[model samples]
Target: MFEQEYESFWKAQVRNASGQRLEMLQRDLTGTKKLLEAVLLPVLGSLDDLILEYEMLSVSGMKIYAVVCLPRLRTVFEEDSFVTHAEKITRDRFSFERVRARSVAILGYTYFPYSRDELEKKASFCQRNLFELIGRVGNVEGTGMNQLPVYEREVLRFAVYNRKPFQLKDVCEWLQLRKEACRQVVRELEFKGLVNAVGGSATRCHKFMISEKAVALLHRS
Candidate 1:
C-alpha cells in the first residue's frame, strides 16, 4: 500500500515539476524513500530494527518523518504487538530523545486520548500530590519505622501501586522537589536496591521503578 502510494506520488512529481523545483522535489522524495525503507519497511521486525533505522536520521529529520509516517501507520501503531514494542522503546535508555518523545506522544494519543485541558488538570493533580508528600516528609525527622526516609518510603509505595516506570519529570511532578533533589533521592534508592533505573539515560530523562526489595519492604511495613 505504501509502495503504491509512493510510486503514485513519484510519478505525479515527475510529471508536474521541472528544473530546480523538480530537482528539489526529487531530493525530498529520495529522503522520504530512504526513511520509508529504513523505518517503515521493518514494521513487523524486531524493535531494534526500528530504533536503529530511526537513529540513522537527524533529529529534525526524525520530527518530519514522524509527523508524516505516524498518521499513515496508525493501524500499525494500533496493533497490540506494536503497542508493546512502542512502550518498551519509549522506556529504553539508549533510545534518542526525539524518537522516544515522539513514540510516547503517539502512544498517549492512541491509548489515553486526552484533551489539552484534561492533561493539564492531571498534571496539576500530580504536582499537588508531590508537594503534599514533600511537606509531609519534611515534618518528619528520621526515616519511617523501616529506616527508609519518609519520602523514599512514600515513593516506593507509589511505584508499587502504579506499577509503571516513571521519569524524573514524573517524579518531580509527584514529589514537587527540585530535579537535583529528586535525582539524589532516586540515586539513593537505586544504591540501596530499593528502586531500579528502568529506562532512559543518565545524561537525559530516565525512568525509575520500584524494585522487588522495595515491594517487599512495603509489604513488611
Candidate 2:
C-alpha cells in the first residue's frame, strides 16, 4: 500500500480595537463551534488516530487543531470517501460554499471576528500568522510530495508559483538541464498525472502546466 500525507492549516483571524477584544471574540465561539459542528466533526472524528486542540491566537483569536492518523496517511486528493463525506458536511452546512473536505494529519482552523470586507483584505497576513503559529505542517522530505522526486517537485513548485503554463525551454533554463533531460522529467510528471501539456499544436507540443490535483496537493505545503 502507498503512503501519502495531507497537511494544511486553515486560519480565521480577528482584528479590531485595542480593548476587551477577548470577551467580544469569545462570544463568537458559539457560532464558530456551530460551524465546526457543521464543519469538522463527522469526517475528522471518524478516523481513530486523531487529536484536536485549541490555542489562544490572540486576545481575540483562537486556533483549533485536529490531527488524525500520524494519525492516518492516504493518497493525496484521491481519498474519495473522506472527500465525499467531508465535502457534503461543508456543502450541506454552508450551501455551495468554498469549504470542502479540508482534511489533514495536522488540520487547523482559526476563529476570527472579522466581517467579509475586512476578511478579504487580510487573508494573506492571516494565513501567514497561522503558518508561523503552527510551523510548516507538510514535511516535504518526509512525504516525497505525492511521491514525486526532487526534480519533479521543484518543477511542479515552479509551475505552481509561476501560475501559468510554460514551454519546455522555460523549465530547461530554470532547472538548468539540457533540453532532453528536461523533457524526460516533464514526461514523467505528466505520466504520473501531475502535469499537463497545453498551448501547442498536435505535432509541435512544447508547453507544460501543473494539474489541479497537484495544485491542491501542494497548495498547503
Candidate 3:
C-alpha cells in the first residue's frame, strides 16, 4: 500500500524541479519522517536492493533520497556493511558520478544533525563560489596551444556547474573519451596545479576537484 504511494510520489517528483522536491520535503518534515519510518526503515537490512532501486532513479531523485531519507535512517548507514556497500557503489563504473558523489556527501552529512536552513546556507555559499570560479576560468586568455585543452576545460566547467567533485570515469562517460586518455588529461591538469585529487590517489575512481589556485590565477588574468 505504502509502496504504491511511494512510487507515485517519486513519479510526481520526477516531473517537478529538483529544488521543488527538496522544498517539499523540507516543508513537511513530519510527513517526511513518517514516510521514512514506514517505508525506509523496513528495508534497512537490504542495502543491495536499496542501492539498485535508487540506481533506477534520476539524479534529482537520488539527491532527494539523500537529503530526506538518509538523515532519518542514519543508523542503518553507519553500519560497516552499508558503508562498504556505499564505497563499492562509489567505484562502480555503471553508476553516475554525480549520484555516487551525492550519496557519499549525504553519508558524511548524516554524521551530525543539521537543519534545512544550515544545508541551504552551505549550498548557497558553494554555488556562489563555484560560479565565480567558472566565470574566471571561462575568461582565461589564449585558446591555443598555451591554453588548457577543450576536454579539460569541459571537465572544469562540468565540475563547477554541477558543484560536485567528479571521478575520471565520469569524465570519460560524459565526454566519450577513452579511460586512459581521460586519465592522462586529468593528470596533466593536476600537474599544472589546476585541480587536486580528493583522496590523493591517481587511480581512476578517486574524485578530483578544482584548485583554489586555478581560480585565483584565472581571476587575476
Q: Assess every candidate by TM-score.
A: 0.33, 0.43, 0.37
Give the poorly placed runs of model 2, Cα more than 4 Å off.
Answer: 1-53, 56-146, 219-221
Against the correct fold, how does model 2 do in TM-score?
Answer: 0.43
**Candidate 3 local lDDT, residue 119:** 33
Worst 10 residues of 1 by lDDT: 46-55
Scored by Cα lDDT, where does model 3 land?
A: 0.48
User: Can you write out model 3's per-residue Cα lDDT over 1-221, one digit (the tens) per residue?
Assistant: 65565555555544543554535533434433342333333323211222211212433564333333232222112111223344465545435644655655555432212333323345354334435433434544431222667777777666656556888888898689999999988888889887888875445448888776554443232
Q: In model 3, which residue pairs have backbone atoms overlapping below 3 Å?
A: none
Ranking by lDDT: 3, 1, 2
Error of 3 at 199 (Å): 1.7
Instruction: Choose the strongest candidate by TM-score.
Output: 2
Candidate that beats the other on lDDT, 1 or 3, i.e. the better one: 3
Residue pairs in collision within model 2: 13-112, 68-71, 69-72
How many collisions per candidate? Answer: 2, 3, 0
